[model samples]
Target: MNFTRINGLAFAFSAIKYIRYNQDFTKTTATKTTDPRPWLGLDGLVLALVCLLFLILATGDGSGNESDARLVLTTRRRRVQRRLRILSSVPSALIVFLLGLILCFIRDPTIFSDIKLGPSRFHVLKITWDDFKVGFVRGAVPQIPLSVLNSVIAVCKLSGDLFPGTELSATKVSVSVGVMNLVGCWFGAMPVCHGAGGLAGQYRFGGRSGLSVVFLGLGKLVLGLLFGNSFVRILSSFPVGILGVLLLFAGIELAMASRDMNSKEESFVMLVCAAVSLTGSSAALGFGCGIVLYLVLKLREMDFSGFPFFRSKSEPTAEDESLINP
Candidate 1:
């Protein structure tokens, strides 16, 4: 009908597509086991609640003492505002979780049905000198530089785009976290790094303050304690399409942030950077190419400025002005 109606219909269709895409249809021959976790049963309920909330929040008040013409206009404006608020207020995580739940229901997977926690082994306490030597020479020495560079770049790019003006020390924080994770690895913890994808995902999912990190750490702790053996299975069950959507949005947001580079030269450099990045899928290569292009352009500009023929005809050179005057 109208533009507003078309937009609303488009959004509705997109939501349906997301739900359909997440529906797992891989036929399994095994019998489905009953899930004992309280949270497991609440998936559909949560989705319904979220949808109901969205509908309620997105609907505007129609009651007014205005004429029929004014009422229609006012109603449309309120509906638009409500839609914006609903879109902005919904957290990305909720969408991901809903998608995962839908997939789980459709597949009826039982991959985690046999998970059970057992007693820890005592051999983990027996650390040998050879282990330390090997770790130092083989693991730490070669990986540290690359890890540090990745962390610094990720932090700088994310902070520059999403949290500008926030004072964040990339080196100090990266090193500190690296050291902590390194120590944790000695006791069988997985090697961890501050990855760009992780940072982007966090930002995409409504993580703005340091409290988000704290809450994440706390959630991990709780999960590890409550479902030690099942943690891997739980995470592995998430739909791939849902994760792709999250990453897609995160990349879009980061790319859109680069629009602030308004100067023509900077814009050209940015386009080069984007092209190289997309072509190679490497941030380091893209950055290097941008730097090289910028330098080449600068050198060419300097060389052209020095040539008399390239100079603007509106301004006379010192030699030409003196000759004319004489």
Candidate 2:
């Protein structure tokens, strides 16, 4: 099929994937429809709708072009935009989360009665050498390339786009990721990376500087120290449908990164890459396909008409050029 047709199909596939992921919260088991898990029930639908409504109300017009903060022509408008940015930066997602907790309590007054407060078990030296070896060989090896692509290269590109004069070097990002993961492994913390999607989400929500990340890190540390595993109880009772709505918005914000693909070829490749990554559940495979297609399209632009074999008799060939010159 032509690339254009392929691109359209790719977009459709991506859209379907996104919809299904969010819709799953509202759907029950296909194997046993008789099971009552709040799927498609009044509670699930109501929770989702209420959360959606609150999220929409909380995010009216957003922080107003945070990327263009320095380009504002008038002082009055700049002041207004700055105020909006500060207000919008209040973490509306957290507000929605708390609202969900309140709704959960209203529905089931004894939801948190079973939660026992205590210090969570520390995860120091939890992994053995053999387990590390196996996991590193099987999982880490395959994920390295994807991490480089998304965590370093894509992040650098997106940061440049979001903060025009900012310079977030790939080298620094790679080192930071490596160091963080190395230290985290000792404490059995989940491996972490600076993903482009996360950066985009931060930018979408009025996070303009490193200070925002610092604040976030501090907040997380404080929460971990204070609540520990006990907080999991509150998180567990939170409505899945509301979480789906939150993720749906995050996905949409991340998808906006593709808006920079202005050319038809780039857009086609991006869509195909995304579709493959989503449908196949392998970013590496999608990266390989995108690279191959990009090279092929680029090669197609070469002028074979200049070759002697491709020229008609009316056009001077390489041999005929010598004859004419003489």
Candidate 3:
């Protein structure tokens, strides 16, 4: 349940910012992203187990001082400070979000109840909180944003899962989640996505607590209990443009980290793999892309050898391992 807790907290944090601070009509269109779905990975408990092993291996300490951990701590602390400095620019959004939380705590719920037609002839239906909770649904499949290489891997992974009690594929999961959501929203529940928006909102809001996320759940629950399907309709019907913008920002930022890290050949291979995935969904095409990319790289025919993991292997190593060891 740690995944649920962690992901929940993330969703909650973002919901606060999204519901309270983001007022612009085009709020959804301002960012882009691709948050992994909740169901894709091992359960939180499993992750904790893995983390425990990793931590045990990672820390060379039966005695903390006996290890080289001091240097690692210093490095971590410096990184945190550097990140804090970068975040100082978004004070207004933070302030507004906090204030909104306060107001929501004491204020009587604002309930909208009506239906009408706009001047543009678009149908307008006013709903309440009761309606919004029904909208919780799965996020979209990542096929649109991910490269062919990733897609092939995903498809293979999914194929493997299809045989038995395996984790569901995101593509198929998204459809099922979407179908259920469409039904729930159609009936009168609050809207929820697969978690991209929630993750984006969480990252935006600095929510790292269960309390933070439960508030979002509570808010939707309150709204759902009051207004029912109307609120879900309103949120679900929110302009795709807004979602597009937010997602776009998120995607660019997500990919940015891996952008530079690569084997020039690997990078080129990855790019072609991604590009092919971009153009076609054929089983043969995806396989051909991956295989061709690998073969070409091995032969040194198609070239674009990048640095390791996209980082320039050429960058001067700050720490000379030989010096330390000697």
Candidate 4:
């Protein structure tokens, strides 16, 4: 009878323990399954703060100042030699941008119709966890390469030509700025990156100093906050032809930078790369093809003596030998 009583108590305790364990498990599962906030939540804010701290720690000292100083000296020397004002084009480009904006507004009167003036109807962007994940996977991943190519590689190359003293790193710019933009994307911000065209435009408009970017950012922020809703519509009215013209000039400027390539072999490679780029409609494809072509040309020696055209009646002339050697 005592054994039976002890067994009953033991069973009862076991059952109680199981019940409590199950309840705790259920609570944990429920918490795990709860929907995450769509917008920049506490977690996102924490992540952003961590990133900011990392950047501050990583770039604590101005170790790059010596290079920048040398660049300034070189720039001064170039300016003195060339006798050209770097800021000369800024006014014209600014005027063109303003004119383009005005023309767009003039062309469309109903551009502001969609903008509601009341405080009650303000549109708020809803950014969910799903949105952030999808953006990171789909948008940001793909954009990194494109931004590095178009913004850093192309822009830096062009900048080097236009401002011989300037130096920029493609990797550093892409990693830091790209990551920040990706973080911003979680909060419903459009994915942003520096671009060659934008850089060229800024340069053309006399934006040699870092202050230019600061001023521009401030202007854009003020404008956006004041007329956030109508901004899209206003931009939509810009004349495509005018924009095309701007792009054309930027392209020309970039092309002109290629003049610095002194070697015939390098020039040939560049031409082939350009042709491949035009045909493939992708800079990455062209870059790959160029690398392959350059390697093949460098490694494998080709002899034209086997061809009938090379089997001349007489021995090769000095002129022919000079031409061949040259």
As a whole number from 0 to 100, the lDDT of residue 322 in candidate 1 is 93
What is candidate 3's lDDT per residue for 1-326, written digit by digit as tens?
11122222333334323322323553476342223223212222233233324323322221122324445657777776555445433432334333333333233233233322232222435556654444223223333333222332333332232223543465664565557656665444444444433433343334435576788788766765665555544454342222332333333222321322345665565555455544534323544676766876577653445545556566445477556675
Residue-wise C-alpha lDDT for candidate 4, range 1-326, written one tens digit per residue? 11111222223333323222222223644222233222243223232334324323322221211233445557677665343332232254455556668766677877757665422333457778997699779876766655666766766666665567875776776686768775775455666776665665455445667898899999987777767756777777664434433444444434443345668777777777666665524556666677798889886666767789867678889999999999
**For residues 176-212, what per-residue lDDT tens digits would candidate 2 score against the true structure?**
9999999988877788999776676666666778998
Give the residue spans of candidate 3 off by over 4 A.
Answer: 1-201, 209-212, 236-242, 257-260, 279-288, 295-326
Best by lDDT: 2
TM-score for all predictions? Answer: 0.60, 0.72, 0.34, 0.58
Candidate 2 regions exceeding 4 Å error are 1-43, 61-91, 103-123, 303-326
TM-score of candidate 2 on Cα atoms, chains taken together: 0.72
Cα RMSD of all models vs. native, in order, equals 11.3, 6.6, 18.1, 25.6
**Candidate 4, poorest ten consecutive residues by summed lDDT:** 1-10
Candidate 2, residue 70: the lDDT equals 56
Tell how far residue 183 is off in model 4, in angstroms: 2.3
Off by over 4 Å in 4: 1-90, 116-144, 301-326
User: On a 0 to 100 scale, what is the lDDT of residue 311 in model 4?
Assistant: 73
Better of 1 and 2 by lDDT: 2
What lDDT score belongs to each candidate, Candidate 1 first? 0.54, 0.66, 0.40, 0.54
| Candidate order by decreasing lDDT | 2, 1, 4, 3
